[model samples]
Target: MIRFFTTIGGFLLGSLLITLLLIFALNPSFLAKQVLSYGAKSFGVPSTNKVDKFLDQTIIDGAIDSPLALTYLGLDSLNFLTGHKSKLGDYSLEKSESDYEENLKQLNYLSRFNQNDMPEGNYNLQIKRFSLDNDIRGYESFRYHSSPVTQFFGAHLSLVEFLTDQHKVNNERDIQFYFDRINEVPRVIDEIIGFLDKRAESGIYSPEFVYIKAMGQIDTLSTGRIEEHPLYETLEKKIDEINLSKNKRENYLGDTKDLIREVFIPAYRRLFNTLESQSKNAREMVGVWGLPNGNDYYKHRLRIYTTTDYSADEIHNIGLKMVSEIQNEIRSILESEGYDISRPLPELYEVLNSEERFYYEDSDEGREQILADYTKIQNEAMKKMPDYFNELPKSEVIVKRVPVYSEQSAAGGYYQSPALDGSRPGVFYANLYDIRATKKFGMPALSFHEAIPGHHFQNALNIENSTQTLWKKFGYGTSAYGEGWALYAERLAIEIGLVEDPYELIGSLQSELFRAVRLVIDTGMHSKEWTRERAIDYMIKNVGSEESEAISEVERYIVWPGQACAYMIGRIKIMELREKARNELGDDFDIKDFHSAVLMNGSLPLTVLESVIEDYIAESKT
Candidate 1:
């Protein structure tokens, strides 16, 4: 879940000029205007060449400097902006340091623009300004020892997932780019190892448990046969689909196998060895509190993740209170569902977990059925979106399984936004690693959160809304805003009658309860020094999550620090603002309009979102 840090470096004088232009001026709004102008080059709204050229300069510069960003955005058609030379990113420490300097230059330039010059109520500028400010703040902190590679999502697996889920191999050029990337894998590994070594020198080491999990991930990638490797297998499958001649296909396949065997496998072996060496000295300590200046580092993490000033004690108390209330609600639901609740809640959960109907068979058919059911839930939820939202996204979202290699450490489910041009559909990857973990009752809330009215809705709307610049759509977002909306979407589904089944309603509450539990356990571990086992035990006891699921969740928080706190914290803040708006606007308040105000500007920090809601309330009163 770590956002890849961006950096700037020294280049030749001519390249520096272009890099400065790219850094100081790039914005998505500018690109939208260009696309609009190009579509109506002749007659419709006349273009202002002077204004257009200025914006185009930013787009061109960004496209050149950050080819990977364009690739991630699925912008192959715009390759001419970068001369169609496809390339991956430079992950070395040297490049990172240079990029940091470049970010400072960009920030310096952005500071010159006065908000007054922009259109009235343009929070987009506010978003960009805040984003640059945050970037600078993080860079200055220099807490590079923070876990960069974890079992969750480090370079080790991201490369594999990127190629399988993202990198398109449509034809010869695309395939060639794929091959070029294969050779770059070793360089990325070495860069990561170098960073890790630097961190170890600073007495920074991930917990022993993390090394154990990550080592398993590395083994999964490096243990298989050359031809059977996921990197080789997935790419080979894609190449077969291409209309290449048999000879060309064989050449590509042979080249890929050789690269995997000679370079990729050996690189992974090196990584495995490095991690194993590091693990010998790894401590059993779980929280950031155990690291050097760890207390201060955790405080910084809280600011970034929750975008709030809530203290660890305050968050811990909030989680405790929310957990109690949710448990009561769940008890009432169970009583209504004909379960005797006189027994302790944990005992009652055993009955719920034992229900075979609530899970699928443990086989390939079960995995396929899970994906199909998620799609069905998304469709059903889409039918109710108009009642609660006036601005639904046009882009489609598909459901897929998390790749086997990463699912062992991945979250239950997550969403990826669609490409800017809509060539690639948004994807919701559900972790079906174990059938028992994918409970049937939780399907609706899970689907709604990761697919429609959740990520798919919030993210696609951001991308589709050309008025909100690329910064707001892509760059300027927080877990609080993005995840908060998704969690809130779960509640919206219930209020709008999308979740009518009593079991489904219970499922939604359980999902929410899990988030609430995070607030407590995350704070207790990081701030209060709760053991990892204690945190896991609390989740299993309270949220009724499987033992293995709870373990994975705890390890995730250990690596991520304060991120688990964001979901509940953000959700609570948004819900509070909604209530305030409803009370102030009274009969004039429209749920649909309130939602539009929150969503249409794309995601924002809780504080900024509160301001936006206040503005909406005042506008409604008048």
Candidate 2:
């Protein structure tokens, strides 16, 4: 009897193993999707709502992981304990190789998945797959240059700041968590150093200028002055706000100070030393154009961001054509304003730069004035948006100066996505490092792009749409779609009469020209092997931006290849669809309804977005 029972059990176990193997072999993507579905269902989100919910959850998850995300969310300090830390360091050639392999595998798996198997309404999945594929290709291209200077290694942006921002010291447990993490920072730095050393051996390194700037930041961070230390200020403020016992609060604060001085400061100092040592070997040329497979990498970046495969030469030609068209418009504006048509574009740029009405002296007062001006622009833009777009977001928008420490490397402006719960407003962070750079004429278009009809409108609507899953609403966004939309918004403002001043219109043209030049410079450096100086010189001549600003922009492109191409590529696609809709529907076309269709699905691959618009145009005609 015992022998018979054992034989039966063995047979059942063998049958179960075969079935499991068959399921895994049949469809790994299906299995993964099933796991994801199970996880989503556990959160009370149905499979149908997977796209939206996935977006929201991913956004929240990213926030949980990224310090920069926390800062953007207005959180005081990041909760790093909740996020996973990367084991790979700057020099981990082995890890880099492994990462590349893993990326390729993931990409292959995604490419094999049938998009048709996804629910029709679940556009987010398709978008996600496209995004993932883009990342994999990007990783594969730049796997050789595993240096910290690159955006991939610029992990500092999301890592340190995110943790320090949302760190709450309200309770004993919270204080302990802060201390515990603070204590571990040295280990993290050590890991980073080890990674960097590995990278150095592989001949991948940052430029001297980058290290010098990075060291200066480290010095500022490690000086241990409470007033200057953003981390200390955050902790003290949190303690003051909460109902913690005085003794416990004092103890926590003391411990925190000790940790900062001993662990955090030391770690930063070590990192600074490592950077200083490596600075000597750093290259003067800034771009991935010199890296292995640089051309292929850049092409992949362009495809991922723009969701198209237009060649660099084609993009460059388009930029030149657009620049000519915009120049003609500027000439009309100049003629209208009684300015000389013969004045050179560069001369005009210089004149515009020096105009007192267009600039404010660099000061705190000037920063406040800019913010106030931004608010005024927002209100005016809001009044005009109803003419163009029907789906206006209910969320409020605010403009603030970029944090003092980060402002130097930051862009002229950036948009922060609205919170999941709608408790906080969307933000447009303007870098007021140089008040002159923040020209008044650019304010109107900037407001429209960063707030109102731009990021704030699109992002808030994504979050607020009841039909979308959390993932679909707040998941990772395509840089092309997001930046392209913002760029497109600038043009839309002009159409609605927001850029009344010729100089303002000039500013708009300059902005568009800047993006166009990016295609040439980005591809030139990464693919054509143009030196950093070549890229910068070309930018100064064509874009008419300040040399310093041009250099920073070039460096950004180098570190983040093909990303700059998204604006023009995305804008063109959007415009093409809009024109197509207009032609098909003729007088029946509703601008509001058109915008609703574009934004209602949230951010999507350009191809998917085009199909959506095409369908909407057909529906409207009926």
lDDT of each: 0.80, 0.70
- Give the C-alpha miss distance for residue 53 in model 1, angstroms: 12
| Clash number for candidate 1 | 7
TM-score of 1: 0.89
The RMSD of every model to the true structure, in order and in angstroms, is: 8.0, 7.1
Q: Write the per-residue lDDT of candidate 1 for residues 515-535, one digit (tens) a residue.
A: 999999999999999999899
Give the number of colliding residue pairs in candidate 2.
Answer: 34
- List the candidates' TM-scores in order: 0.89, 0.82
lDDT of 2 at 232: 69
Q: What residue runs in model 1 are displaced by over 4 Å at the alpha carbon?
A: 1-63, 80-86, 110-119, 124-126
Judged by TM-score, which candidate is best?
1
User: How high is the lDDT of residue 371 in model 1?
Assistant: 91
What candidate 2 gets wrong by more than 4 Å, as runs, is 1-45, 49-113, 119-126, 139-141, 144-153, 168-175, 243-250, 474-476
